[model samples]
Target: MQFSGFFSAAMMMIVLSPSLQSFPPAEAIRSSHLDSYIRLPSFQVSTSPDSQDDRFSFRKAFEFRNANECGFADHETTGVCDPTLVHVAITLDVQYLRGSIAAVHSILQHSLCPENVFFHFLVSETDMETLVRSTFPQLKFKVYYFDPEIVRNLISSSVRQALEQPLNYARNYLADLLEPCVRRVIYLDSDLVFVDNISKLWSTNLRSRTIGAPEYCHANFTKYFTNSFWSDDRFSGTFRGRKPCYFNTGVMVIDLVRWRRAGFTRRIE
Candidate 1:
């Protein structure tokens, strides 16, 4: 299904989610119960890196609840597929674990219905899961391992070596990585801190579009490519009849349903 709305920003990526609704009060919801959770199918990994030995420790965040007007909070455990839950995805690796944790904390601190938010963490390492569990004991989240080999051959040299990391491309595969039940998700970079209720942003209507983000229509989009790319119509023809705008992939509202239907992961690979 296509979402409705236009979000304008100089640099941002846009995406989608399920319809919105009022959830029950936060006081009735308890994090201790862990009965049913949707398990993510594992990706085939070709290599085994050394185990994480010195994982960072974080203080558990104060659990935030929904206001009385909010509905859908249940005494039983909330499943990942709950229509009232807001789905958000973020990549986790040793290099950005601290920032990810901080970002999660910031989101919880500012959300009107923190307990209604579900996090889908993408990771290249297996050990980060334990670390995240300890840090956010009450957090409703799941970790999905993304094999680096999936993008190893697809990467080319870049001006900054950090941009070439395999995990950096993890967002491109969200349609393939997350559960089929999860129709839409917000993909976030570790560097952002939210000052407003995320549900406000989550409530965005993408109209008939597959994604939504802050658009930078004024930037010099051509400077992102090499001279040879512009010289060949075969290489640059992809933008033939359209106006290309630069967007910051850091924050995006992605409609996974549309993304999968469009075969975006295969296209990116």
Candidate 2:
């Protein structure tokens, strides 16, 4: 069952961002008026016109921007975890290290979940060994790795290409190596922590839809994915063609069955 050396592969990417409160009220992010604007993927730092999507901004969609005057780490500072995060896949694909996992624990420590629920992890060769030995010894989940060389081949011809995976590379590709039993999963970024229980969040409904995410109240979402492709058709259908709903990749319930049935992964590619 193991693809082993046949396919290791590579890539990094962007998805969505969340709010900024442990007990995050949607109202806080709503105030950002992000609802009024379709947040496009752009570089965190800008140096040239050609470097707009330079970093994995879109992949960081689940992270929260600090609104507090003093900057540090606060579990509740960003968006709150959904009540049903358990039903989905809580995953982290490690490219390097940024204490994102610590942040994930900050919330999960308090958020409730089924004892059997598992936290999936994907990491690079450099970090994979340490990840299991250091922080995750008995956390109740399976950790897997791929030939760094294969990942390199997917990108170029050397495993060094894997060194550049921006941020959301894991979430964007984790499902590929997942067990067949995992037909659907909710992907959450490590930057987030839950202030409450997530059992109910996983239970969120899909209703044959490919995914279930909070619909945005305003802003033409079509532009978010369109502006880059020169045509809005890429994800013009992400929200069923309705005005973009506030779809946060940090917290989304995806129907893998539909995702596979409709080739959602191919669409995202």
Candidate 3:
């Protein structure tokens, strides 16, 4: 039942830019039209010189039967704009494609209203839409291409090269990538699978908070920073009067309405 360690361990292997670790606005930053900067190339597994051995293949016929409690028949007829639908966002790449598929399967299997859930997938590769549809023919999903160049300059050196990948920061720009009608969304990491109905998590109330997640106040927050950061009052003093805690970015319920209104993505850059 304890998934904290599992999530933490999995996340350690998948690195993200240090900028994404905390929330603070940079000085005089401007937002760019990410859509115009990066293009999703055609699906070519062999394009990379070393990609010949890195082909990804999944079961072409993986399907999940919905529970009777799930009133799915009507949901199929409903559009994604329908207020009744639950929106879930996840990233898809070669490294985590299998885990992402399994996570989708687990959600559908356990959800009481499987048909009401619509997925918003952030992908950097081409032909991902075709791949996802082939796996789950009945799935309600759409793919958004996240350009790596959008965050390349914002990223700093990390312990692992994987953490510095542009796709890892894609979560930081979900508000800009998804449809504006999707006011709320559950951003899930591709590495984990769920045993419970994801809709339960989707329905959580953020209240006045821009985002909500399990916070670990007991964990040492200072360890995430460096001696130089702590040594300087100008940098360390930012946490004054505020109680900071550790929260895994792997799972979160984000209020995109509040996020966009506040211009959080611009600040993060």
lDDT against the true structure, each candidate:
0.68, 0.42, 0.69
Off by over 4 Å in 3: 1-49, 65-78, 158-160, 217-244
Query: What does candidate 1 score on TM?
Result: 0.71
List TM-score per model, in order: 0.71, 0.48, 0.71
Best by lDDT: 3
Winner on TM-score between 1 and 2 is 1
Instruction: For candidate 1, give the lDDT of residue 238.
Output: 77
Model 3: colliding residue pairs: 15-163
**Which tens-of-lDDT digit does each residue in 175-209 have in candidate 3?**
99998888899888776667777766777767788
Query: Which sequence of candidate numbers ranks them by lDDT, best first?
Result: 3, 1, 2
Q: For every candidate structure, what is the RMSD over all alpha carbons to the true structure, in angstroms? A: 11.8, 15.5, 9.8
Any runs in candidate 2 off by more than 4 Å, and if so which?
A: 1-99, 146-167, 217-246
Measured with C-alpha atoms, the lDDT of residue 139 in candidate 2 is 46
Judged by lDDT against the true structure, how good is candidate 2? 0.42
